[model samples]
Target: MNGLIGKKIGMTSVYDSTGKSVACTVIEAGPCVVTQVKTEQTDGYTALQLAYGDTKAKNTSKPLQGHFEKANTEPKHKLVEFRDFSIVEKAIGEIIKVDDVFNEGDMVHAVGVTKGKGFQGVVKRYGFAGVGGATHGQHNRQRAPGSMGASSYPSRVFKGKRLPGRTGGDNVKVKNLKVLKVFADQNLILIKGAIPGHKGAYVILEKK
Candidate 1:
């Protein structure tokens, strides 16, 4: 009710009412099955577990297979729980489609994992300008993180230094993205602007 599990399909440009081209991200939002319902009395919380994307039963764990069987549905690749779900009365195995939750012009928040950029330097990771030009013996120091800390005052690098190791692959939430279109027949929704994650990655779209 409050949100739905979705997958990032890709990006495309659509013309708005003003005939201006607007870039949008396409998402396959549900046809998700209600897999579990947790009540405050039972679990000390109210949430609805929704499952999306199909997977082979052989690839699914036995416990998960049994869980899906209880809902009268096949194994799913992604399962997300919506806390304080608005539709608490939805029976298990009820399908929540894109149109059932979102409408065109509605604002929503998209939560996803950003693309992973492994082992990057500060220049790429934190958008640090390279250390000056290639002159003055600064050949290898161009992309190096300059002046980490005072050598005498702080013998070691600070805990939260800007020096980069791993970059991205973070759980990110982009808020207030307007819904451009919703195709219930195809179970797809087009959202204005970009969201996190790569194509085919799972995303959660929450109504604002």
Candidate 2:
């Protein structure tokens, strides 16, 4: 996939050319540096390793420091690779801007880790109907799972049964989102709709 790394800068609504309001995710996309280029004969695959977000030398370890040195650039907060660079032709230390690969009305995909909601209930996690009788005789059946297993027929809870436990904090991908705007001066690329993860979170943007 043709992609780049970016930071989510929160969401906002914007009016399109037709004066239609659209929800958009503001992202501080690349101006990423091409750290390394690998070819089939050398690395057995064609890819360009990109680095984004500057990090101080004091914060980076020696091995990572050397890696940045190989790129002849400062330490970066993240690194990712793209398979094809024929359209980019980026060299080591070459900067990649958001406008280089994305523009208004272009379809793109974003991948990010969703916000965590720890230890959810069956009703909240699996959308199961909770035990009823809120007024009759129920005391605390509102959020209970109620019947999980059969009485004597099944002594133990069945495996793979839908039950509430941990929730969210998972990798999620939002696909075919239209690029609403690309602010090259600010390195911001706005896409239509809400994206996974919170503001300032790292996300991967891929052209779809």
Candidate 3:
């Protein structure tokens, strides 16, 4: 379950060796520091707690400050756990880079929050075709979820019925994205296909 915490750097099209443009999402992966190493004997699970991104000491809490200090690193804005990291032997305070966990042509998955669309209607949220042939005052009820319930059947609208409500802003996982390129010098990674969330959104990438 080796993985890395990264940030979405936006999308771009890159040409492969065959000279065909391939759309990909650029990500800034780590040089993540191992903040804590959990073991089955002590924590009931095996996981590596990694920290990434620079942060001012004053902006971080005292508890987090002590944690980073134990690892002998500066305060990091993002902290993620990679459970059962089996790619290699990792020690406390060790550095793991993008290339260390992934390589070109490797199949991977990305997890992140989808872009929030805020409140939405059934037509846009659930792709409801909506009522048609505006008849019997149906014009105004086109998008409305017609009839809540039968007069005397269920006696109430059924729970979990699809209706107008908030859309997006959920955890989305895009699986089997190819590792298009890796820039170890700049700590940037290019993954094939679109990933959810806006630019600068935190993303978790793990090998499939």
Candidate 4:
């Protein structure tokens, strides 16, 4: 899972070489700095700690300021650990460009947190059919989930029942998405189809 921490820059449509129109999401990927490299001997496992997005010096805490000092880079707004590869071979402060790991037409996997929709009802969250009749003295109960349990049988609802409460804002991983294009100068990566989460949200892209 050697990948880069990136931001979704929204989506657009592009024409492929075969003259086919393709819809894609644009991501502003790294240029991320290698902050720390962990090893089994010293840290118990091999991993690379990458830092992306910049934070103003004044806005950053003193502790983080000290951490960036060792890397000889400014404080960043986001820091993530990627363990799939031995990134420790890269020196501290070493930069990983998106181009180094991916190219156009490469299959990729992306992980992101979806937008939060807050509390939701079963009809919207679980695709429940909801109340059947609109008439016959039914109004507010139209969206209700009807009976939730057997009256005197089990005496309780199942643990994993699909009753809805909170919705969205979950970590979602989308796999086998194709990379439509790569713009190195702008750090923009065009991915086929929609990605999870809203524009400007952070996402991790892995070569598949």
Highest lDDT: give the candidate number: 1
- Clash totals for all models, in order? 0, 0, 0, 0
lDDT for each residue of candidate 3 in 10-100, tens digit (9 for 90 to 100): 9999999999999999999998999999888899988899898899999999999999999999999999988888843677789999988
Q: Superpose all Cα atoms of candidate 1 onto the true structure and report the RMSD in Å to 1 decimal.
A: 1.3
lDDT of 1: 0.93
Tell me each candidate's TM-score: 0.95, 0.93, 0.91, 0.91
* Alpha-carbon lDDT, every model: 0.93, 0.88, 0.90, 0.89
Q: Report residue 27 deviation for candidate 4 (angstroms).
A: 0.3
Q: Candidate 2, after superposition: displacement of residue 146 in Å? A: 1.7
Tell me how far the alpha carbon of residue 105 in candidate 1 is from the true structure, in angstroms, after superposition. Answer: 1.3
- Against the true structure, candidate 3 reaches a TM-score of 0.91
Superior candidate under TM-score, 1 versus 2: 1
Residues 163-188 of candidate 1 have per-residue lDDT tens digits of 87999999999999999999999999
Model 3 CA lDDT for position 156 = 79
Q: Ranking under lDDT, best-scoring first?
A: 1, 3, 4, 2
**Which regions of candidate 1 are displaced past 4 Å?**
none
